[model samples]
Target: MTTSDILRAALVGRLTENGTLTDAAWAKAATAVPRELFAGSYFVPIEGSTPTGYRTVHPADPGWLEGVYTDQTLITQLDGRTSPEDAGEQSVTGAPSSSSTLPSLVLDMWQRLGADAGHRVLEVGTGTGYSTALGAHRLGDRNITSIEYDPLVAARAASALRAAGYAPRLLTGDGLDGDPEGGPFDRLIATCSVRYLPMAWLRQVEPGGRILVTLSGWSYANALALLDVTGPGEATGRFLPGYTSFMIARPHDRPPRPVLALLPGEERASRIDPAKLDTWTGSWVAQLAAPSAERMGSGGNQILSDVATGSQARTVPDAAGGWTVVQRGPLRLWDRVETAIEAWQGAGEPQQDAFGITVSAAGQRVWLGSADGPGWDLPV
Candidate 1:
């Protein structure tokens, strides 16, 4: 075996030992595939003499080839297209469209799925085909159906999978709808992040089946949940501690709106207690609780209010790096919130640790905490 092969083996071994891969099937899959073949020119390499930690696409170099197969990430596409040719030869922007997810994260999510050979799996987001290849290795190609939103990416991934000797049924379409033709799957795994669980996936999968997805809202964390499909259109599961991020897959090809433009004007120049503003509110909390809020800008100049209720206020920085808050109308809410945050911080700068969503027999609750104790709560 080559040095790259040895490194691949060690990476797979680490994943297996870390409880991410319980069955030997996944390990075998990881070992059998040459990750470099599916990777793009730019890949993160192992640390060493070739400036290994940097991203490079020098195909001729031995280090580059080795970097391709290592258990690190590779930038396959940027901004919905193949990376610029010049970028392949130089250090450039690192916006990633698809990649073989970090090994540990992949293994953890795959294990969470608990797929057996008999299982029929529908995988959303066929990026580098690495994870799809792993699924095929475990459940066989005939039983795997993978979807990719980008037609070009879907085609490239299909070709790569075939070249690697694994051919699952690949589809170029929105994964939100799923492949209706391959219905009643035993397991549905989404490698992409989603704002809300698609109802179509729930409708297509068999009752008591599992759906593992990276819930897109608040906590900014992934949840590996088992969906019973108990009712006609409802499924539920508690959140699990898994961290992963994927491109947002949508029906259209348009890019996301810039964050700065989305900020409300009232929030442009407002005073805020930095401590209160930094509380462990769930991801969606900001959007829901403070719809027109903006994180304080530099040198505090302007403050924003909803105008209708003025319940929330936003402050921006002034010429110097100082914050200001302005409040008006019915909602003198910002002042109270600022005070609460300052009070909490005065006690101590509490480090908020685990924040997660809970869905079970009782109901749904979102909780936040640090090493100390619970800090806040929100209902879903």
Candidate 2:
């Protein structure tokens, strides 16, 4: 077998062992797409290091192809601007803007989406064209429309797709808006996370079609939801089990806030441990409790600041055997979070699967247990 073939087989073997590729057509497509064509030189972030501090790996580098075949996400862009090719061997410092998502998650989501040969799919966030190629291969290239927001990234993905001999309609625009001219599609799949379901997606996708996306918020807590468009401007769905997250949609990202200034505030013994803010379930509940707050710090050092009102809460160890929380501004950030934590706990700490969503022209609302159960209006 050729090196690419062997690499592809090994990758598939790994994915199969982990239960990522259940559908045969998708597995074949995964083996067919040359991930290296899309990734090229990529960045590997140093763990617990500066966000932008990464080592660049080129095809010529020893074991680079092996790295490509590894079941891991590869960083492609930093700070929304720089690619590894732009920075070369240097370790730059910034947030990762784009990536080739881990293959297992990619295939898992695609499998759950259930788009088939007859279905025309609208795919959002065509980051590396890897997922796009899989979609194009499984369905027909003519049956797929992939939208990418970053012009440079879109152009690169286009080049990669052309090299791979597949051509899907690639649009350089916000995926949230979808493709107006090309839609009313059969399925809408988003690779990025949004705070709430977009009404545009509901309108663009035909009634009874599926919309798969990650529901995320300012806190970056996220869950994958599969919504079925029930009518014009309406859809309802439930969060699937398992942990899933994507980078927050660019437009839905919180606005830049002032650098943290730890100011003194109303101090009291904390009713709940600040450490809860760092756990997966706790973070999800805390985000629901204070939907507008951006969380920072970790464990007992947790800090939460309201993005809109400038209210802040900082936790410190109390000499009297518990934690002390200091609060400032009009909004009591900790109080809201504590209430949410209590609610989630009272409900037996249900998993994300117990949550569901309803979307309409009015807005989207996420609820726990049932449509008539405890819920919150997603900030649209």
Candidate 3:
């Protein structure tokens, strides 16, 4: 066997051991699919220190090619363009337009879906059609419906799937609407992260059907929720232990506005000790959770906020061995942040891990540790 084959076996082993895939069908699908064919010229290298980062590798390099195929993610499209050719010289800024999700996560999501040979599945964000191919392999192409927002990507994935002998119905449209023509699906899986669950998805699935999606909010982490449609317009689920980051689907090609634009300017200010800003305040939490927010720091100087509005903020160490928050906001949002810190400290310096996400019939809530007890607040 080739090195790629060996890596593929290892990945399958991990997936089976992790309980992400159990059936012989899943193993056959994993082994049959040629992962490198879907992966573009480059793949995003997985880093130990960071969740994701990009590293360019030539297609001819056997080691890199095997690594890309076996380890999981393949950066199919950078930014909004499908391949480097379409992106021209501007590819660096495009972000990840399409990718083959990590194998373990893909199996985990598929396992959560509990799909069978007879089930009808609607997969959102058909980037590269690798997952669609896997589903088609398990359930057959006639039972799968895949949607991709980008026409270019949709066309390529359609062609790729057909070439692979799995001709699932492929649609190029906004997946948020959940292909009405293909109604009443047995399972709906969103490969992308969404700020809110689309009502159409909830309405389209049969009662008691499962809808698996990644819900991102104003928090540092995103939650993978497995919700069951209990009623006409209700679904409930809690945070899954793992986290993932996916491109935000937008109607237009342009990216969403920056988060900093929402904050008041630094000039409109009240003075406060920067050391007192609580990182756990609702606003900061909200900012961290914002989809537009991106990390802009290298170690200590790093900042996290929207790049468009230029709302930059960071934390630095002081002589006293404490951290100071340095922020530039129009209304001295930093001052409010300091007040929140004081409130938290006055109550008690809460340790980090005490935070937990609570989901109820009404909505989701985030709780923080406090001296008296756990303090809870609603997510906006």
Write model 2 residue lDDT over 1-380, tens digit each, in one string: 78877998999998988788889999999988888898888898777884437988988999888988999898898879989898988887777778999889989988998898889999999999999998998998999999999999999999999999899999999999988999889899899999887778888999989999998899999889999999988999999998988998899999999888989999988888888778777888788778899999898888999999999998988877689999999999898888777767778888889889999988778888899987778888
Give the poorly placed runs of model 1, Cα more than 4 Å off: 43-55, 84-86, 217-228, 251-313, 316-380
Quote the lDDT for 35 in model 3.
Answer: 70
Give Cα distance to truth, residue 250, candidate 2, Å.
1.3
TM-score for each of the candidates: 0.72, 0.96, 0.71
Q: Which 10-residue window in model 3 sums to the lowest lDDT?
A: 262-271
Task: Give one digit per residue, the lDDT tens place, for model 3 in 141-239.
Answer: 889999999898888788878787888989999999998888788889988876667777877877777788765543233556677777755665544
Candidate 2 weakest ten by summed lDDT: 44-53
Best by TM-score: 2
Tens-digit per-residue lDDT, 158-242, candidate 1:
8889898998999988899998888878889988776556778877887778888765432232334444555545565544543
Each candidate: what lDDT?
0.61, 0.88, 0.63
Q: Which is superior by lDDT, 2 or 3?
A: 2
Candidate 1, after superposition: displacement of residue 172 in Å?
0.6
